[model samples]
Target: METQELHRGRLIDHIQLVVRDLDASRAFYTAVFDVLGVPMGGTADDYFWADELFVSTADSEAAEGKLTGRHHLAFQAQDRAAVEAFHKAALANGGTDNGAPGERPYHPGYYAAFVLDPDGNNIEAVYHGEAKRSAPSVKVAF
Candidate 1:
């Protein structure tokens, strides 16, 4: 292993999710992502893309029903305004808000909003900028 490769930008390219029903998951992601102006990679089962990164989902066959844990997926937004738009769109598309758009001082200026997809997966939109001393904290009711 020479390890001589140099990376140009962000390393992550895509993320795949396993959902119980592909159709429901696809609708949820499409609607929420559409609000953020992310295009759906047309006619490819259940797949959506933002820039060069793609997020896809497929039917899961674990046989134990929906898996539960702290697993979550997050996307970086262009700005704080984009994050807020995503939150509003997600809620309108039947996604439950887990956390509203705001800064998490504990995480070093992490402005993010979280929503639970149709399959109960936690999805987040984040914008990381200059650190701030005080930022409002929002607790989601649903």
Candidate 2:
């Protein structure tokens, strides 16, 4: 089995997204994460993961029941270029364009791109301009 780690520093330790098709979700996420520079953690018969995100099919024990419904999830990108790469990658990997990459009214310098995954999840990549962080993240191995 491939070992992986998750960063722990926020209110939510982790989030599991139950997908209808693990293979499709995996391909979609694999492409997107590659642009974001996040490594694919591991995979099982019914699930696969990347960084802090866990994606499993409804048949997986972790899901317990049904697949997840439409949801909006925005991942932070290092820069606007990364956001553009994310959109291009997602589209090349079975994702539909929800919104083109551009600055939004959400806030100044909030350049972002949006796409719909195989399961219709509204996934986004946003670069909040330049900023300083104390730490990239709190590493937590599992």
Candidate 3:
């Protein structure tokens, strides 16, 4: 097998969103991820990625020309300002506002923003108050 390394969040290893319009999705995600401080992992004619989220055209080999159903994916933000910035950047790049930046009842300091991506997937950026992290993410190699 080919050697590889990955950085992952606590629960999910990665998520692949197969979209009808790869370009539109890429644009939307690029802007949002930029504001969240997540760099694009890599890209190709039909796909792109940032952190653990992979986006692709249905025509991409792995997608087998099948689009995935709408999904709710949330990203962690460093602070409330990042969440607000994520909303603005997403809107300017083909995203629709689902919920503007604000605190939610989910918990104290559960500030977040939600947007519908090019394919209507519910995307969120959240900042759960100030907290410390032992590590940014878990790393795996093979």
Candidate 4:
């Protein structure tokens, strides 16, 4: 079977998090992203990526010789159910709960769930209730 690689040309392009344990981070992300509907795009001895997010070991060049500090990253969810599912999968895969699934104070219609990845980075899944957009996201190829 063949799988398509996700695009990599957003305003942020890509974000990489260098981790202490690549394997543990890998397992944690795999479980959470699965519920969010993103697949593991590719992997190497020291790194792996899914969509625009990349995870690598401290030795990877992308780390620039430093492990990243705690960061808060939020992934968009299609609905409240997906957000709930992401939290469950994360908890089952070595993640610690930061916040349970619920409506947040961020705004009305902002429902989110947060977890701490193995490295203590905040991972979140959020659904903005309902919205209409001209397109799903920016698409570019090179």
Candidate 5:
């Protein structure tokens, strides 16, 4: 639980999901990330990452041989098209559709899609309509 520097946005700096199958999770994430415009940051024998999210096997050092419970993680989509593409990519990979791309009642302009990852985590891609960000993320150095 230590790092010299990290990029953070909104509420979370990073999140780690310890899974049972690394390859399946990797495939699912790789495809969706491509649609979301997030590059695969890096990979090791037991894990892979894209931006702030990390997927690892239970054997990975940080996982301590324990698999994580189901979790929900939502990624920001550039637009409604990105949300649709993300759903398509996820379904084509190792994901199962949880919800189709459409507007949601969470708030006005809440367009999103949801999918279950290989490990059954609820993964989502959402576009909150036209808006502006002060910065993409905050960088911390140590």
Candidate 6:
């Protein structure tokens, strides 16, 4: 018997996050989503909507005194303007700027911005296009 191949589309369904504090996670994600114009859904301690992905947070089980590196997550933006808006909103909502919106030679036409969430998670909003001569100026904290 031949096995059937499953064909799936390229959209993300959801993402799960194990956070120390559910309420804080909710607030961070809610603010981030609002900035990106993404609707937040689900009740506390279980689910929330971020972009097209549903994110959930649970208790962390790591040992004490050990540091866990930052977790990275990226969201797709409608355009360069949206990415810039998201970066601005994230800074206003207590997120730290990791990187500003700009072009990267690593990926062709990659314009993106990075932010560190309240829980130290790395979040990014990206748009794929050719590098523009004039891009929005974003303030960075030293």
* Model 6: per-residue Cα lDDT over 72-118, one tens digit each: 56776768998899999999999988789887564687887878799
TM-score of each: 0.44, 0.52, 0.53, 0.52, 0.52, 0.45
lDDT of 3: 0.78
- Tens-digit lDDT string for candidate 1 (1-142): 6655543432222343555566776678778878987776745555444565444443232211333323356776767998999999999999888889998663676798878888777677877775442523333332
Q: Point out where model 5 deviates above 4 Å.
A: 1-69
Clashes of 1: 0
Which residue pairs clash in candidate 2?
A: none
Q: Cα deviation of 23 in candidate 3 (Å)?
A: 37
Q: What lDDT does the true structure give each of the candidates?
A: 0.63, 0.78, 0.78, 0.77, 0.80, 0.64
Q: How far in Å is the alpha carbon of 31 misplaced in model 1?
A: 38
Query: What does candidate 2's lDDT look like per residue over 26-112, in tens digits?
Result: 999999999999999765888787766888877776554543345547788888998999999999999998789999875689898
In terms of TM-score, the best-performing candidate is 3
lDDT, residue 1, model 4:
46
lDDT of 4: 0.77
For every model in order, what is the number of clashing pairs? 0, 0, 0, 0, 0, 1
lDDT of 4 by residue, 1-142 (tens): 4544455322343466777798899899999999999989666889899987888877776554544345547778888999999999999999988889999875789998878899977677888788786676755533
Tens digits of lDDT, candidate 3, 1-142: 6759989765433466877788888889888988989899665898788877878777776443543346657778888998999999999999988889999875789898878899977678888897778998889987
Over the stretch 34-93, how does candidate 5's per-residue lDDT look in tens digits?
Answer: 998999966598988888787887787645454434665778888999999999999999
Q: Show pairs that collide, candidate 3.
A: none
Off by over 4 Å in 3: 1-69
